[model samples]
Target: MTDERTYWFDTMQRIASPVLHSLANETLHSDLPTETPPLKPSALLEAFGRTICGLGPWLGATDIPENEKAVQAEFLDLYYRGLANGMRPESQDYMPIVGDHQPLVDMAFLADGILRGGDRMIDDMPEDVQDDFLYALQLTAQIKPYESNWVLFSVLVEIMRWKLDDPAYSQQKIDTLLQKMMQWYRGDGIYGDGQNVHVDYYNSYVIHPLLVDAVTYYSDAYTRSIRDVVYQRAARYAATLERVISPEGTFPVLGRSITYRFGAFHALAQAAWQHNLPENVAPSQVRAALTAVIQRTITATDMFDANGWLNIGFYGNQPTMGEGYINHGSVYLCNTVFLPLGLPVSDPFWADPAKDWTAKAIYGNAPVPRDEPVNY
Candidate 1:
C-alpha cells in the first residue's frame, strides 16, 4: 500500500481498536465515581458516543472493510442508548459549565447525526425530539457584542448548512457570527478565543479551522464578497499558526485540553485545504511535528486501564490547571485529531515533507518568519 493508504488504514485501526472495545463492554449513563466532573449534562456521555459513531462511517467511507461492521454496530448501540435515555425529545437541555456551549453540543449532534448517522439518527429521534432539536438550533441564532469563543458558532454554521441543505442556508447567522468573531482577532493572524487576548491553542485548534470551513461552505453557496473576507482572515490565521511551531516542530501546548496535544492539526489541515498553504506553512512538516507530539504524550497502554479508560495527560499523569470540565472520554474527542482524514490521501500537501527553519536556512530558502502581535 502507498504511504497515504497506510496512514488512512493505520489511523482508522488505531481509533477503532479502542473504540470498538469500549462499545462491546462499556455501559453509558453511569454516575461518575466523583461529583459531577467537568463538562456537565448526562447528554455529553451520549454525545461522545455519537461522535465516535460518526467516525465509523467516515472510516468506512475510506474502505476500512465490511468486517469492521462492529464499528458502526457499536456506534448504533450507543446512539440509540443516547436517544432513549440521556436526551429528552421535548426539551432543550444544552447548558454549559462556562460560556455558552449549547451550540457545540448542538453541532456535534447534528453533524454526527445527519452526516454520519442519517436514517438511523432520524429514526432514533422521535418527532418531538426533532422539533426540540430544531428549536435548540434556532437558539444559536443570536449575535452578541462580546466575542465568546467563536469556534462553536462556526461549527454550528457548518452543521446548520448540512442540516438545511442550503448552500446559503444560514447566511445571515453566519454573517453575524463572523462579524462577532472578527472583533476578537488582534491581527497578524492571531485571535483571542474570546475577549482580552490571553493566548493558547484556540488559534490552531478551533479559530483558524472553523473559519476556513465556514467560509468555504458559505462561499460555495453565495457570492465572492461573503467568501473572500473569511478567506483573507483564514490566510492570516494560518500564517500565524505556522510561526507558533518551534524550530523543534512543537507548538505550545497551552489551553484547555493540553491532553488533546496534536488535535490542533485539524485547524492546520483545514486552513491548508481552503487554499494552497503558504510556503512557510508546511503540511508535511506539520504532520511530522504532530506525529512527534502524539508519540510523546500517548502510550500504547493508554487503551487499557484498571477502569478500562484511556489515560494520558498533556503534562503526564497529572491533570493540568486549565482543563475545566473535561474527563477521560471527553479528551478522546481529541481523536478529532484525525479529522484531516477528510482531506483525500492524494492531496499534494501530504505528498512531501515540509522544509523547517533549519532546512530553509541550510538550503538558502526564504525563512519562515513570525509577525509581532498588535495588542488591542
Candidate 2:
C-alpha cells in the first residue's frame, strides 16, 4: 500500500493527468466533458491552473524515489506537449482569454504554476516553445481583476513577465500590488480578501503565498521587510490551522469554498514546506496533522467521478457547498495541501517520526508547551 504522502502526490497526478493529457494533445476542447460549468473553456483552464500549481514544487524537486522520478518524467513530457499546444493560436488546444473577468483571473494561477515550475519545466522547453509559453502567459494582461486579493492575480502575471524578461513588464504595477496587500492586512495573521473580510480560505489559498513568491522576484530592503512580516503572519496562521484538525481528522466545514476541503490548509502546508513554521510548531507535528487531514479528505466518498475527474464537493458530492462561481476545476485548489510532499524525503518534515499534532498533543498524553500570543 502506498503511504499517505505518496498517495497525496499520486492523487495530485491522477487529478491532473486527464485534463492535461487532452489539453497537450489538442483534444481537451473535444474530449473534456463540460459538467456543472458556467463556462466550459475557462473551467477547463481553471482545472489546469490549479492542478499545475500544486505540481510545480514537486516537479521542480531534483530528489525523489525512483517511482516518483518515473511519474515526474511521464507528466513532464505530457506537460511540455500540452504547453506547446495551449500556446499556439492555431492549435486546437488554444485556451481562450475570454474577458477581463474570471477567465483572466484564473490566468494568474496559470502564471503562478509556471513560476513555481520555471526552474524545471519552463527552462527545459525548446527555445521556440519557451517563447510561446512566455507569450501565452503575458497575454493575461487583458483582464483587470477586482480590488481585493484578485489584484494579486494581475501582479502574479506581471511578475512572471519580469521573470521571462518581458520587455513590457511594469515595475510600478508590482509595487502597487504589494502596497495593496499591506493595506488589506487585518492584523493577527489574517487578511481581508479585498475590501471586506469574508469568512473563507482565500488568504491561505492565494494571497500570502503569492505575496511571499512575488517579493523574491525583485528583492529589495522594503520588499524583504514586507516579506518577513508576511512569513511571520503566515506562520502564526499555520499554527492556528493545525489546532482546527480534530483528532478524528474532521474539521468545521465553514465559510465559502468549503468544497475546497483541505486546500484551506494551503498556508499551513506551505509554511511547513518553506520551513517557516513558528518555533513552537514542530515540523513533525505539522506533517502528522496534514497527513491525517489528507487521508480523511481524499478518502471521502464521491470526491472523484467515475472517470476520475474531480467533482465539486467537500466530502461526498455535496455540490450545494460550492458557490455559483465554483466549477469542477475550482475544487482542484485542494492540491495545494500537498505542498509539503514537494520536500525531499530526508527533510525533517518527512523524515521525522510521526508525532501528535497540536490537537492530539493537548488532548492525548503528549506534553505540549503553553500557547503564546503572536505579537506583530
Candidate 3:
C-alpha cells in the first residue's frame, strides 16, 4: 500500500479502536472520558456514530489487501458487537437513540454509517441485532430536527430506512426535507446552513456530504436532476477546499466546530472518494493535501488523552477552542477525512503518483492553473 493509504488506515484504527473495543465489551460508558459529565451520554453516541460514519466506506470495501482485510474483519466483528451492545437496553453501554435533540444529530451520523457501510455491513447483521437496529432507527424517526442543517439529519435517517426497505420510511418527508435544503443553498457551491449563511465549515462538515448522499441514494426521475445539481455544487465546494490548504497542510481555522480538526474537508474527501472531483483537481493532489493535513493535525501533542480518546481541541488540548456544543465525542467527526480510504488500491485516488496540491504548487512557484469561482 502507498504511504498515504497506510497513514490514513493506521490513523483511523488508532482513533476508532478504543471506542469500538470498549463498546463491544460493554464498557464504553465507564471508559469514555468526557469534558462535561452531564454530556457523557451524548458524547458516547457521538463517538460511536461519527466513527462509523467515517469508517463505513472502508469497512464495506471488499477490494483491500489481505492484511488490511484481516484487520478490517476484526474491526467488523467489534463494530457489530458494538452496535448490539449500544442498542440493547440491558447492555451497560446502551446509547439511547431517543432523547433530547443531540441524538438527532448523531443518529444521522449512524444512519450515514449504515449507508456507507452498504450491504456488507448490513447483510451480515445478526437477526436479533437487525431488529434492534431497525427499532432504534424508528425511535430516532420521531425527532424534530432544527430548521438549519439539521434538516439533512432527518433526510439521512429516512434515507437509511429507505435503504433497509423499512415500511416506516416516508418518501414525502424525505422529499420535503431535501427541498428545504435546496432552498437554503446560498449559491457558489455553498449552503446557508438554514436561511442564513454561517461563516463555518458546516457546508463541508454536514450540508454537502449528507445532501449529496441523500440525493444519490433517493435517485429517481424526480431526484435525477437534483442529484446532478447537488453534485455539481459539491464539486465546486470541494475545489475551493483543496485550494485553501496551505503548503504546510494547515487550513484557516475559520468559524465554529474548528475542533472537528481535519473533518473540515469532508466534501473534498468525498469528491475524491466518489470520483467526483472537479475537472481541474487531480486525485493525487487531494491525496497529498489530505495526508499532510492528517499528519499535521493528528500528530499534534495532546490531541489524544493517555487512554487514546480525542481531547476537545483543534490543535492540541486547547479547551478554549471548543464551543458549548463541542465535547470529546463531537470531535470524532474528524474521521471523515478517511472517506477516500474506501477506494480500492488500484483506483486513481490511491494508484496515482502523489502531486502537490494547488496551494503547494502556488507557494513553490510551480506553474498551476488559475483559480476561478464556480458560476453556478
Candidate 4:
C-alpha cells in the first residue's frame, strides 16, 4: 500500500471515519453542518441514506482483515448503538416521515444500509434492537414511493424484509416494482429515470444496483432471467462509465445530485464487486479507473467540514452545488464509491496490479480498444 494505493485506503479511513464515527454515535446531526435546508427531517433522512449506502460495501464484508477490523471495530460497534437509537420514538437521529414520498426515499437507503451493513448492522446486534430495527423498517410500509427511481426504494425495503424472512410484504409489491423498472428500460443498458427520460446518473446510482440485488431474492425463471439481463446491462453501463473518466480522472458534472460525488459510480462499482464487469473492461482497468476517480474526488479536495463531516459540494465548500433537497446527509451518497471494498483482499479487483485506465492509456500512447455498445 505505497504511493497511490496507500493514500486510497488511508484516505478512505480518514475521510470516512468522521462521518461513520459521528453518525454511528448519534452525533452526526449535531456535529454535521446542516447550514441550510428548510426541511430538516427530510434532510436528515437524506443524510442517513447517502452516508449509510456509501459504506455498504465495507460494512457488508464478511472477511475483513483482523488489523483493519480492529481499526473500524469501535465505530462499527457504536453504529449499531446509533442505529438502535435512530429507530427509537425519540432520539436526535429519530426517523421521520417526510411528505408521502420522501420517507420511503430515505428508508430505502436505510434498508440498503441494513442490507449491506452486514452482521454488525443487524445479525450481531442485541436481540431486542434487532426486533426494533425490523419494526422500524416495517413502519416505512406506511409511506408510498412516487413513480420513478423512487420505485426501487420500495423494492429495496421489501428485499430487506424478505431477507429478514418476515414475509411482512406481499410478493406482488416486489413484482410490480420490478415490472415498472423493466417498463422504464430504454434498451442498450439504459433505463429512463421513471416515466420520462432524464439526463442523469440515476440509472447507475439507484436503478442498476437495486435491479441487480432485488432480482436475486426470487427464484423464478422470470426473475432469474431479468437478473441476467440486468447484469448484461450493468456490464455495458460500467464499461461506458469507465470511458467517461477523463485522463485526469474527472467526469461530467451534469445533472442533479452532483453533490453525490463519486457515488455516481455505484452501479459500476457494484458490477466490479460482483465480478460482472464487461469482458472488454479489465477488472484492473476498472479498479484503476475508479481508484483514480476516488482519488480525484475524495482525496484531492476540501470536501469535508472542519469536523470532517462531508460538505455539500463536489470538490469543496460550494454550498450552491447542492439543491434545495440537498442536506448534509444527502451528500454522503458518495460512500457508494467504496463498494469495491467489499471485494476480498485476495480478489482481483484489489489484488491485480494497477493498469492504465482507458483515458490514460490513450493519452500515454498506449494501445486502447474502440468503445462499442452491446444490444443487451
Per-candidate Cα lDDT values, in order, are: 0.49, 0.77, 0.88, 0.75
- Evaluate candidate 4 by giving its C-alpha RMSD to the native, one decimal: 2.1
Model 4 quality (TM-score): 0.92
Each candidate structure's TM-score, on Cα atoms with residue i matched to residue i, is: 0.67, 0.93, 0.97, 0.92
Best by TM-score: 3
List the pairs of residues colliding in candidate 1: 38-325, 39-325
Model 3 alpha-carbon miss at residue 256, Å: 1.2
Question: Candidate 1: where are CA atoms >4 Å away?
Answer: 1-26, 31-39, 42-146, 150-162, 165-171, 219-226, 246-249, 273-276, 299-308, 353-376
> lDDT tens string, model 3, 42-109?
77789899999899999999888676988899999999999999888899888886657888899889
Q: Given candidate 2, what's the lDDT at residue 232?
A: 84
Report the Cα RMSD per candidate: 6.0, 2.1, 1.2, 2.1
Worst 10 residues of 3 by lDDT: 216-225
| 10 residues in a row with least lDDT, candidate 4 | 1-10
**Candidate 1, 5-33: lDDT as tens digits:** 35544654554344334332343334222
Native-referenced Cα lDDT, model 3: 0.88
Model 2, position 228, has a per-residue lDDT of: 77
Q: Give candidate 2 misplaced runs (Cα > 4 Å).
A: 36-39
lDDT of 3 at 61: 92
